[model samples]
Target: MQTLQAQIQIPPEFVLISKVEYEELLNNTLDGKFLSLKEVAEHIGCSTAYLKNEILYHPRYKEEIEKWCHFPTSSGDHYRFHAKSLYQFLDRESVKLFLKKKY
Candidate 1:
């Protein structure tokens, strides 16, 4: 049996750190971080209105979206999304699209 290993070359401008340090930094950065609806919509490359109307309210993904988001006001006109959850959801959606195309 043989084992294979791969190495990734870090760019000149990038700093290399141990996994533990990276994890610590990530945790510190993400702790209690929440993004506004407009910020999230911009990050995902969609207009706020489109994000709210098409994906957030769409039947296929609304339930899942709600799990990671909250309406801060009684009117339900404002949304704040947990940073980690939003990233995870986007990653899952990306994988789903990839598999759909591959198959």
Candidate 2:
């Protein structure tokens, strides 16, 4: 009996994400799935505090964020994110960045 081993190369930009995150992305491709603030933060790979401060509350992205997120209470402390819309928002931002760099 013989054993063989092979080596695989990963690209520099390739990211290694946990199984939970992978499943979250795979399973939440539809528009109706709602995610809590914490889950959105994790999916986007940012701290919850940073998500709230920079993206959620920032003036530049606030309007777009609001389109896909909801505040369930009058206090505006809790957020529920629409998974597909959130992903689309991120994709649009990335494309904007790419075009900015190309010009």
Candidate 3:
């Protein structure tokens, strides 16, 4: 058997998100609605592939998404998330920008 792993090159802008900013992004972006990946992509005006590649499937955000994205089950690359968690994961870059300006 052989294993292949593609190296994920994180952009220079990635940052560790604080709990408060994460919560705030959720509050601003979500409205207690549970949605599928496709729906979420629509809600945020992006392609589902973009969401998966940049946020969910990115190794840089794996730990954070595991903690906050609320994946209901572990099954391949297919996953679902509560709206808030999904937004938090998707909007983390924006949250980092917000934090940069706040302090």
Which numbered prediction scores highest in lDDT against the true structure?
1
Query: What lDDT does model 1 reach?
Result: 0.77
Off by over 4 Å in 1: 1-20, 72-77, 95-103
Query: By descending lDDT, how would the candidates be arranged?
Result: 1, 2, 3
TM-score of each: 0.64, 0.57, 0.46
Question: Between the candidate structures 2 and 3, which one is better when assessed by TM-score?
Answer: 2
Clashes of 2: 0
- Model 2 CA deviation exceeding 4 Å by range: 1-29, 75-77, 95-103
Total clashes, candidate 3? 0
Winning candidate number (TM-score): 1
lDDT of 1 by residue, 4-78 (tens): 999999999999889999999987786689999889877877677677766678688888888889965676577
Task: List clashing residue pairs in candidate 3.
Answer: none
Angstrom error at residue 74, model 2: 3.5
1 versus 3: better lDDT goes to: 1
* Per-residue lDDT over 1-103 for candidate 2, one digit per residue giving the tens place of the 0 to 100 score: 9999999888999988899999998866674888898897777666777777767787888887888799656776778888888877878785542343311
C-alpha lDDT values of all predictions: 0.77, 0.76, 0.65
